[model samples]
Target: MPGRTGARHAVVRPPAAGRTAAPVAAGLVLVLLVLVVVRLPWVGDLGMHAATVQRLRHSPLDPGNPLVDADTPSPYYSPWMLLLGTVARVTDLPVFAVLRLAAAAGLALLVTGVWRYVKTLSAHRAAPALALLSLLLLWGTTPFLWSGFPGLHSLALTVSYPSTFTLGLAFHFWAWLTRAVRGAAGWGVWLGLGALWAVILLCHQFSGVVATAGAVATVLAARPRRTAWLRPVAGLSAGAVVLWAWPYYDFFALFGAGDGLEPVHRVLYGHPVARFGLVLLGVAALVPRWRRDRRDPLVVFFALGVLVVGAGWLSGHYSWGRALPAAVVPAQLAVALEAVGAGRRRLRAGWAALLTGALLLGGWAQAGTLGYVVPRGALPQALEDRYRPPWTGYHWITPWVRYGDVVLAEGRPARQIPAYGPYTVAPGYPDFFLPDEERRTKATGTYFAERTPESVRRGIEREYGVRWVVDRTGALDGTGLRAVARGPDGQVLYAVP
Candidate 1:
């Protein structure tokens, strides 16, 4: 009888060793991420963000196009960047240093926010840790690095982006909303949540969409009481008010401006199988969740995300691909919840093994992210092979290129020079708000054409206040501009005569 009773108990409860291991593994992953944040290696869009901070620091109220000298308002001027800009101005810290600080704070918020939100889903002690690990590692073996996605490699690269900070806030917002809608809460809490929703939208519009989808799923799954229904309405009203009252840029105009963004975002739809194949496991996990409760929050959230992303692909509104997280995250969390909350002993063990295998595969695929913290040469041969070199910036031109000086350069230098407080003849990234963007682009191209008349080149120089020129070696050797410095990759910086 004692032996039979012990077997039943073991089947009912998870092993103590497994429970202890989950948290330890989670802690170690977070520590590794912190080291990456400390290194703060340059990658995609870092230049644009750094330049945005530089502009905001110098002129907060009127900071214009981040990569050019236009006076037009920019969408990048969010509440988070404003705060970081203030820090830069007051402390006189380099923009990248301030970015490192931002990265650390964002990482902390993300960690705590995940913990709080997962707690609302399950009382199981291991659920939060498992959820964190699942969120970071349940993607396909192919490494998909992007701003809004929080896969380990992507998060490491975009730790400093507004998307990270805003996504962190979104998790907290969802947690608070879940609790507020379920329990009796005052009108003030609802109104505050509404304002927070607006702030999240303002901070990173794409993440805001993801947050909104999750919010709807939360409310739907909760099936709040009739009295609680009015609270969401009041909260939404407050959010609309905040969005309207924001003075930096017209928030509503963004809805109609997706046309210009579609081209670049089209790439997000490529390689559907390679980028997200492993997530199907989570989808398989969702079947049991749906069977148990048809209106499961995770299922509802995944449905909504699929609705948006699928529509984006079909309708040519690919920019909506940013909402991929809405679908991806709920599925990831469902797997974690199942691993911890499964009822049958064999079923639970099966889920545990599957999740463990997926995580190991995903971690190895992103092992190259370790190169961000350790030297590339020091990485194991396999990791080094996977590692990508970060952008080598145009800091060499800083000695000659003063603040706000317009440089006529067309490729990578055009993208990177603005980070050091100089503007470029053409903005490296797309600029929907800049009225003369087309004209400036033409002027830059005309200046660089080999057969252009010297007089026409000089005219181009005076038109945009082009103080410097950066291009390939000997590209403009006879243009009469004084050669200021030569940088890596055959880039030459010339002072306009």
Candidate 2:
């Protein structure tokens, strides 16, 4: 029953005259909830993840592989999909609605955690509230928004990404770890830490890397004597081995053998110098506090965030770069909020104005995102119809697709049909773990575009075991496929027979 010892001295106390924290926190939650309501069934990864949940609901015992067109065994350790799928089954709710609800829940948790974590960093009432506002709205202005940057994809992908779910959970774990390391926690805290990491690892392997590393850094900072290291290191390693080892071992060889990176269009907003300048500004801002708060556990946490991004850029891994926001943003907010809470009257005012402006900009950016029909761009007429009520693009073709049937479809159709239906989509989204994913994806373009000869068609069908084709735009010229279904949007589903 050692309550948070030194809790009062943990951070600078808030000024006596500041506004109440509850209303601001509730407002932030409302904003996120509104977003979830407006943007239902988000396209891209969200849609795909929803598709996976839907599949799991029907075949809870054997969900098979939701990623591909065939029942190729899934190598992913996706506890998130299983959790949502189980909920969908029990509640009898539509998969898309489940996805939206999950998003709202995640955002709520994230805001609440932010509010709590900020209190540990600084006691300024506005610091926690302002930090929440800044992060949710001003995210687009960060370097992470750069086109091709990992941050853009990570945040934009929303609920579909297992990493996205980890955002709030990780922070709460962080708060608990800080308390536990300080000897304020009991045996239950230790158990909770281990259990949390296990869930994180099972949810996403990449998140495990960041979370485990962060946890280790936290333990090192706390420097707790007598078996302190044992619990964190042992717990994290065990979870990694149990959840991560199997999928990685199964897929690592294939991942390494896979082809090189394909080019993607970059979306650069500010000049390159602007990004660097922001980093410089952050470092400069931290310099004053370094002498005073250098040994602070949260300081180490912030350094780890910078290290993750720097290493990501040097190692040529986009995942690390994209994930920087999730791992680092909280730390960034903490740094700023602490500065605001601990600074003088004039200094605090300047910081507050900057944060407020950032929040406004962030809100504008979010508006733009919500206005878009799809995450990447405007959805095609075919895809637009797919999201509508009663029946959709996937509905038209799914009935004809049998289990284990490999169907050839273009990228849009490929991503959608297999997600909501029982069939596997041919040449679907590129999975780094799937060895031939890149090769198959490239060939898909050629197969759909060219006047493929019967010889080529037969060879492809023979090689990939393709039996049906969803021709969205009359892309099947030389491939002799018989039309079995015509879609509302001029889409044709062809059977090889």
Name the best candidate (by lDDT). 1
**Model 1: per-residue Cα lDDT over 1-497, one tens digit each:** 11121111112345898788789989989988999888887778888889999999999888888898878888888899999999999999999999999999998888899998887877667888999998888888888989989999999989999999999999999899878866777999999999999999999999999999999998998887787688889999999999988877888989987988999899889997788887888988889989988988889999999999999999999899999999999999988888877487688888988999998998888888888888988998999997878888878988878899998888677778888999998888888788888898888888888888889989988888888999884658877888879899778888888
| Model 1: colliding residue pairs | none
Error of 2 at 473 (Å): 4.5
lDDT of 2 at 251: 34
lDDT of 2 by residue, 1-497 (tens): 12233344333444554455424653854554455444543445544665678667877667656756444445343666677888999999877777766766665566676677666666655666666654544344432332112232224435335555666666677667766786656556676688787776556555555666667656767777775666666555555455545432243343452233322312221253433223333344455556665655555655776676666556654445434553345444654564455547677667555655544544543443333234434644433432322124476665777645677777677767665554543435555545567667766666776666677767776777678887777767445678888887788888875
Model 2: residues >4 Å from true position, as ranges?
1-29, 60-62, 69-75, 142-157, 184-188, 244-284, 370-405, 425-427, 432-439, 442-446, 462-467, 477-480, 484-491
Q: Single out the weakest 10-residue window by summed lDDT for candidate 2.
A: 261-270
- What TM-score quantifies how close candidate 1 is to the native fold? 0.96
Index of the highest-TM-score prediction: 1
Candidate 2, residue 22: the lDDT equals 28
RMSD of each: 3.8, 5.9
